[model samples]
Target: MPKAYSYLRFSTPEQAEGDSYRRQMAAALDWCKRKGVELDDKLRFHDLGKSGYTGANFTEGALGRFVDAVQAGEIERGSYLLIESWDRFSRQNAMTSTARLFDLATAGITVVTVDDGQEYSQERLTGPDVSPMLLLVVKLSQAHLESARKSNNVGKAWADKRERARAGEHKLTKRAPEWLSLEDGRFIERADRVEIVRRVFRETIDGYGRRTIVHRLNEEGIPNFRAGENRKRKPTGWHASSVAKILTNRAVIGDFFPGTGSTRFRTYQKEAEPIRGYYPAILDEDTYWRAQAVIASRRRVTDDDGRVVQRGAAGRRGSGVSHLLTGLGRCSICHGPMHIINKGPLPRGGLYFECDTARRRAGCDNMNRWRVDEIERRLLKHLTYIDADAILRGEASHGEFEKVESVKARLADAEKRRKNRAAMLEAVEDMDPDSLARYRELVADVTALKAELAGAEKALAQTAADPGLKARLAEAVDLNRAMGEAEGEERTAIRVRLAEQLRQLVEMVDFHPELSIIAHLKPRADVPADQVPFTYDSGNWRLELSSDSEPHGIDPDIFPEEDPDAVRAANAFFLKRRLAKAGGAS
Candidate 1:
């Protein structure tokens, strides 16, 4: 006796819940039993939820594998290929789909269509009769045409929905971020989940990497929010990739992307232009971008193969090591990395930061050994908050403030012009060609200005939300407090987080041969690299203006005019006497 193989397929997964799956399986089994052929139950081929019109079944699905086996001599030559109909195999192009059916028949395998009870064997197909081949072509052509009409209808329906969504008459999708819920056709932030999202962003802004944040979340046993509430299995713990996606997702800032590709029968789609203010914002744009800046600061520049080609000072922030400053420390003489060297034990021997160049005898000779614990302690205490008061007093928001005011002025002017134009038009009994043209021109101008103003205001909000400077300082303060309270491994973790935060503030720590450590602080926390070097000398216990030959006081322009007293105090913190650098007063 010959063997029979059943190949079943359906376009959408929803069809499995309908009569498609059961009907096709029953037809295949019934036909095989009646013909007295052994059904190959071990090698069942079913392309569930796969599209036939796109030829996905014949390309990547199980149907393709079945055909390949038949052609490769894995299946017997007299074997039967059972399907519900010709459409169940493929609704692709007429010529291509017909070729697939005949290809199996020519390979000595009989193709059986159970619905119409038609069999296309090598003998019958290559016989003198033209009706069988003509019928196959006609059936496949009709299927292709039917699929094309249905595809067009669906595309148009989605286009209408998108247009309506843009007009605020409809919502584009029911799917939303895990932190938000789709209620009454609108997305609302879930308070509990929203807090978790906020914490992730805060941790990132505080110099905690994605892995660190994921570890903390998992250790705390926070219920990891995921999609598909009806899923059988849920994530037991947080993942680094999931945490990274949450940090980078624009949906947190109320952005909705409608995607560029056709999503009707597809699972994944490419993101197109974003629809702003689509959801109730869980995070301000500033907090979102600040977190992005922090992430970018720690990200090492990698090559095509993900090999680290260049690394910033903060690139080694979350290496799970006890070294406080690995990438940030540089030898003053050779400008090489200061690597930590362990001697013997705890009390008798401690970890020391040795210049890698001198230790390895590579290029330059500058031997300066600084105790790791002492360097970490003094740097955390003195350097972390060196320019905290100045930053928190609102100096960074100046540039963005001016931008908002400028946009507001232009917006007001546009509004006034629009009102004047409307009044003039209403006063006229009959509008002339010139008057109509002028009215249209003013309307466009006012609309463009309004849009500009909205963007300017959003940028201003992000500026006011400067999580970079103020957040870093607040994080350092908390870390300092936590270090005093924490012990053992927890203290070490806190030290790593503090070092990451310091990397955002302090650009470099140079250890000279004379036992004088120079701490070079950056102009701003948000910037990863800067040419302007603000130095704090351990020998003098004071902050210097720059590396220039002449030293000057703090710039007056940075201070807001409303609070002169606060400005004077901030100036005093910088110019006044302070603790020495990591090595202490020389």
Candidate 2:
């Protein structure tokens, strides 16, 4: 008996939950049973949510695979291809759909529309029966026309909605940012989600990196806003990318853009310009821009000669901050990054920070190394005791915005120059060599100035939005306390947080040839210039040892009343039993 393969396709995924799947499958099975052919249950072809009108089912879907298999002889020539209707195979243009049908028939594969019970075999298609071929052409053409009309109507509907939204008639669909909800045709902030959004921005502006924010959110058991919405898989906990999206979304500052894509895919191929003040504001403009600037700064750090001193893969900072000072310290001799090199394992063989150049054996023989555990502990302890409010914020001057003002001035000057050049060109009536050169120079200057202005403004906004040095130091002190109390993976996460904080706070850590480290702190808007670079050295700072080094416990009693051999055997037996129990529990 010949095998019959059933092909089912639905233009939308929602139809899978309806009767389309069952109706099509049942028709195919019934046709196979009546015709005395075996239905091949193993090879199931389903193209869910793929558009037949766009020929997606043929080009990028399972139908295409089936056709290829038939042509390659992997599927036997005399088998049958079963579909509920011709439209289920394709709603494409008549010529294309006709060619597809004839190709399958010519290859000795019978095309069966189970709904109409039409068997379009090779003999029927190639024989002198004009009615069969004309009927197929008519059906395909009708399907194509119907799909085209529907696509047009849907596109127009969405376009009208976008226009109405622009005119402020109503909110653009029920979908809003994860922090918002739709109610009464307007968007309202969800309290819990809005708080999470605020926390993401606050932490970012406070110099906590995205990974640190992810760790903190997951540790606190905050529900992920998108967890329930994803249909493809089970919910994953908070991720760094999710935190980054929250921090950078312009929707938080009330900006919205409506766009359109292909009728089938629904992704944005053409996005309209953003409409300012469209959504309800969740964060101030300053906070949003500051988060952007801080996120940019954390991406990469460059040295004085314009060489990138620290960067991880995929244009992102390494999520793993294993060493306390990874990406924070540099070689005093060559100005290269310092990294931790492990000698072997624990107590005797330890980890030490080695200069990158020295480690590569390229140049700069600064063989001095600092033991990781001792330095980290000492540095953390010193950070906890510092009087940040008195030293950093008390007499601080607010000059960060001056940079923005300077950039604006330069941009204005460039625009004036461009306008004057245009006036001169109009007066001249003909383009000379110097005039053309001057016009080009003016255009170049304006373009460069505009880019610089954007950067300056963003940096200034970030500076203004930041919570200042005092707050950051207080956070560091708290983190230190937490880290001191935490162990295992929790301790590692705290270290990552501290490392990100230190990278933002401290300008550079210089490992000298004298076996000492000098940390130069970055200047802040709230700190006085005379009080900075806030230079400090390991030699000047001393680590105060903690007295609670060990837990209180009594010494073991050596004397026993039972026979020594029997006692030893019983103790060994119980120890083995306890070990077995522990393994089982794990």
Candidate 3:
């Protein structure tokens, strides 16, 4: 009996016909019985979903592996490689088909086509008579030509469908995920998930910083998309790249781009490519552009050489002081965070703050440093000058008073409108269509007004009636008084308060010894400098001669006389000496 291995393929839906896998297997089994061939179930191969026209690209499929096994002599020589027909075997390029035939003949394997009734083998090709071989090659080439034409037709149909979808015409493809669905032939967002997506976009646009936003979202218990049905996967934290993606996604704006291919050959094309817009947009184009602007305005920090340092690694030092300056101060040159360092030994350590930018970036002119003690002293003096009486007596500047008054007036107006709208709505039962419509308009206006009113009231309450204000002011007064008449822990508490308040107003504290200036002010440009009510420096405490002059009592000459090199050297020597002393005592 002949050893026979069946190779079966159905390239198209028309070819499948009533002859599916089960029918084809039965036919192949009957053919084996009729030919007196031993058909091994293990050797039976089928490429059901794979296309014979693209056989050259095949790998790991049943037909591909069968060809590989035959070449490797895994099957005995003279074994018959049975197939339904030449086209079912392959309709690949002419060169590929010819090469495969040559390989099968060289290996002593007999290629037998059930439908064509042609047998191919090395023994049958004596002296290149070639008539039978040429006929088979011509038939295979014709099959390949037909397959190419069909492929082109299919691709053109797909292109037409894609173009129509891009024009906002809906064509049913695959259904969306179970949690989402199409409405009015467009993707209508699920309110819950849509809100989360919108929030991600909003946070990215607001410049909360990617990590901060991620932290906030996770803190709020927002589940990530990939989390399983019952298992809620909250955002571990937002990465900057993730935030950037959310900000740039067109999906939020209600546009959908189809995947490049159907399920069998899916691909992702470039986002900017023309695509189907099958969904209603949740965000406007202007809003998306605004978010991009916010992302652009954020200033990222870098080292002295203009290289960015990872946020986690930057400002890792300083004994509980660095946190105070985290977002408040940055290196003027590198824009890196300033690190706080204590200059002297423990039990009497003198503190100073230096910009990480100057340390990391070579040749940065802004190697500014400030004595922490002097900053504290000057800040205390400035706090004393604030005149607690001025705030308590409502003698604060007109601008400050007006800010509070404006919020109050807005809140009152909103409440009044809400009341008037409520009265109008009550009379709507007796009104005609026009009156009812007018009443509804008033109701909407009142609802909006009341919402604004609530927000205004909250702002005013935070500014005017905040418990933190009185407590902070009292703490500032006590600290200022202690600086004049206390030592040790008492002074440290005062320094902490000064640092906190100063941070709220000061963007960065630059210490430029080269310029003989201890503090370089980058005040919030919106707030008047006079409103800050403090001068900063590394010197003896003094009230500002004028609201604008240096607040510390030390003359400007004092800073010029003190060399930064000397100060650093003194600090280093002091640290080493303290270390030696501790070692010796131990």
Q: After aligning candidate 3 to the native by TM-score, how far in Å is the CA of 77 from where it should be?
A: 2.6
The window of 10 residues in a row where model 1 has the poorest summed lDDT is 525-534
TM-score of each: 0.64, 0.61, 0.45
Give the Cα lDDT of each candidate.
0.68, 0.67, 0.54
lDDT tens per residue, model 3, 1-586: 3488887776445555655655666666777788788887776676655767777324546767877887776788888877767787778877888787778778888888776567888877544678877777888899899999988897768667766776656464656532356665656567877676677665443224456556566677766554544546544544556655676666665555454433543333432232424655677654554455434334445699967532222222222233334444445455556666666864467666677667667656666566655655554433422323322222322233334333444344345545654565576676546335545655565576567546644554445443233223343444445555845644443333334334323334444444442333333322222223233333322123232453232233432313544423433343355456547868
Q: Give the 10-residue window scoring lowest on summed lDDT in candidate 3.
A: 311-320
Question: How many clashes in each candidate?
Answer: 0, 1, 9
**Which candidate should be chosen as best, given TM-score against the real structure?**
1
Q: lDDT (0-100) at residue 269 of candidate 2?
A: 55
Residue-level lDDT tens digits of model 2 in 1-586: 5699999997666777679888999999899889899999888889976778888888988999999989788789899999999999999999999888888988889999999999899999888988998998899999999999998998889878876786788676677899888888878889899989988887665445677778778888887987777478866789887886886577998878676664465645534245567789988765666556555545566689978755421123344455656566678799887887888888778889889898889998988877877666655533522332322222213335435544555466567767876776788867767557757877897899789777876666566554353233343345545666878755655554455445545555677776556665554443332222221222222222222211001012421313444433433443355456547868
lDDT of 1 at 514: 62
Root-mean-square deviation of every model: 11.8, 18.5, 18.8
Better of 1 and 3 by TM-score: 1
Error of 1 at 514 (Å): 14
Error of 1 at 115 (Å): 0.9
Which residue segments of model 3 deviate by more than 4 Å?
Answer: 10-19, 42-45, 56-60, 125-131, 169-180, 204-249, 258-260, 265-272, 276-278, 285-586
